[model samples]
Each structure stands twice: as C-alpha cells, then as structure tokens.
Target: MLKHFNAKSLFGMSFLVIFVLLSSGCDIIPGRHMRDQAKFEPLEASSLFGNERASQNLPENTVPRGEWYDIESNEALYTGMQDGEAVENIPIAVDRDVILRGQERFNIYCSPCHGRVGDGQGMIVQRGMKQPNSFHSEQVRSQPDGYYFNVMTNGFGVMYSYASRVNPEDRWAIVAYIRALQFSQNAPLDVLTEEDLEQIESVVE
Candidate 1:
C-alpha cells in the first residue's frame, strides 16, 4: 500500500481532503474563521456605514412604535416649527401642572448651564464654563415659545440638543417654565397679586 501511493498522489489526496473540508464549512482556524460575522453595540461606530454610525436612521416615512402621533400627525408639536418658522406658541396647553413638570425637568437638565432662575449663572458658569444668555434678557424673552422648544430640541450656539434625553412634551413643559421664570423677574405691577405685593413690601421694609 505504501509503494502504491506516490508522493504526488499523496499530495493530491491531501489537497482534495482540504478542499472538501473547506466546502463543508469546517473551521480550521477556530475563532478567526468567521470573518463576515457582524457585531455592533449601541453607539458604536462601524465602517460598514457611510456615516460610521452603528445606529442607522429609520426608513423614510416609517414611524416607530408609539411615535405615530408626533411623527406622523403633529410635526409642529414634535419639531417646534410651523410654516418654516418657530411656532409663536407652544402647541400643548400650558397649565400649572405642566409648568411644574417643566420646572422639574429644567432643574435637572437646563439648570446646570442656564441656572435655577435661567439667569445663566449656573454653578458651571461660576466654575468657568461659558455662560449662556439670561432668559430675562429682552432678546431671549421676546423669542417665541417654539423658539425655545426648537433650541432645546436642536440646540443653539454652544448648547447641545436634548432631543434624545427630553421628550417632546417635556420640552414644551420646560419652555413654559422658562416663560414663568422670565415673568417672575419682569412682572408688571398690575399683574401682582395682593399677597405678592405684601411679600415685596415686607422684603423692601
């Protein structure tokens, strides 16, 4: 049997065996054999995409689950825009409860840079961070409610977008709260309640 097998015949048989094994998907190299397997973690970058983002945008015209109302029907509510401009009013109704919710969300998110009263004197600013414009400033106070909502959703200047962290409804709530803050610092005498007047008089006294 040894004499019957020449060197070329043995080499040919070995090559044939390797070819069959490869065709049948044998993992000769163990862990390194699966070169085409794709594994992507959240927020990881990938060269497979032109944007190098592992997370791809949803298909056009397809709304994700539980987002149809905002994405499909109420674009203004979600994006804070109408007719190519920021809407002059918040699309959602403003109420005490909504304002309170806004206050809570704003304290957690915006207060770091905008301050508790939106004076742009937050602790970060005192610690040498760039100070944003005060909400009480005439320029800011004159901006429409949707303008603030747009800034919160899309960001402006050095501020980053909160669209991912703050939901649309809560963003509107924060906008309402910002208005309340502005009014508190610049309220007219006629709009003050008796109790408010008394408090001011006591403070002045």
Candidate 2:
C-alpha cells in the first residue's frame, strides 16, 4: 500500500534531498575526467615541462598527420596564390578522377551555401540565410581557379574558411568541380562540337 505523506513530512524530505545534491555539485557524476582535468590555460606556468611552460614546440621534423609541414615547399598549393595573386592554374593535375573527387567534396562542403549546381540556392539559403553569389555569374566564371581556392582557404565576406574541414588538395578538386559547373551552365553554343550538338539535339527530341 502507498501511504500519502503529510505536507510537513514531505517538505522536510524534499529539502534534505536538495541539500545533498547542492553540496555534491557535479563531482557525484562519474567519468568526467576530461571536463574535470587539471590542464593549464594558455600562457599558464607549468613546472612539469623543462621550460616550465604550458605549451612547448614539438621536436624537430615531427610532422603532424593531416597538417602541412612546410608551406614554403609549394606556396601556391598551400596559400592558393602566386606572387600574391590568384594563380590562373591549379598546382595539381586536374584529371577526370580528380574532378569527380572535387565534385564529391564540393557537395559536402560548398553545397550547403552554394547549392549542388553552384547557384547559391541551397537549403540553408531557403531558410532565411543570406544567399551567396552564383558561380555561373560572369564575374565568378571569369575568376581563376586559384580564386576559388583562395576563397575556400581564407573565406570571403560572410563565409567562413573551410581550411580546417578541407585539405589543400581537396580544395583544388572543388575548384575544378566549380569550373565544370560554370562551363556546363554558361558554355557558348558556338564552342559545342558537331558530335556534342547531336547528343544534345537527340536528348531534346
């Protein structure tokens, strides 16, 4: 049988439980070592290191995985510029497979803001987010492939840099994919070969 407690008795029991929880705070929970760690903040003093510093440089030639060891080796590839200008060409070879890879990467990273077809009409844009410029625009099509790489690396107005999410090689692949989109949408009919025209004519028919 469930017995109902008097109001005074229940009030005392609730106050006791609240007191216990308040006193323990979060320490009563288990497996919070990372959050409860004793790590020091930046510039904090730590006698654990030889220099008694919180931060120390990695040993010589200690190349961290998924990081550029030396930007000097290829400044164009890393910084997306040559002589402080966007290069007219990609540093790496732009093969069919590479462009396909770029297409995949672009869909993952750029499509959220730029759309699948580079029209800047992605889902987020429909949801009241500021729309970006279409890649098919004359201004964008005239820009060099390195310009796209530079934008992805450094970010343009209202867009954040994807450098942390996308590596340099994939950034070029995305540029190639963007160029492919521009050509597919804005290529002149005069430039189409006889065979290419026939394929399009048959599809339309």
For all predicted structures, in order, the TM-scores are: 0.68, 0.74
Give the clash count for each candidate. Answer: 0, 0
Candidate 1 wrongly placed segments (more than 4 Å): 1-29, 32-63, 66-72
Task: Score candidate 2 by lDDT.
Answer: 0.89
Which sections of candidate 2 miss by over 4 Å?
1-57
| Candidate 1 lDDT by residue in tens digits, 1-205 | 8897998999999999989887868376566557646678888998888999999988899756753344558878988988789899989989999999999999999998899999999999999989999999999999988899999988898889998889999999999999999999999999888999999999999
Please report the candidate that would top lDDT against the real structure: 1
Evaluate model 2: give its TM-score: 0.74
The window of 10 residues in a row where model 2 has the poorest summed lDDT is 25-34
CA lDDT of each candidate?
0.90, 0.89
lDDT of 1 at 145: 86
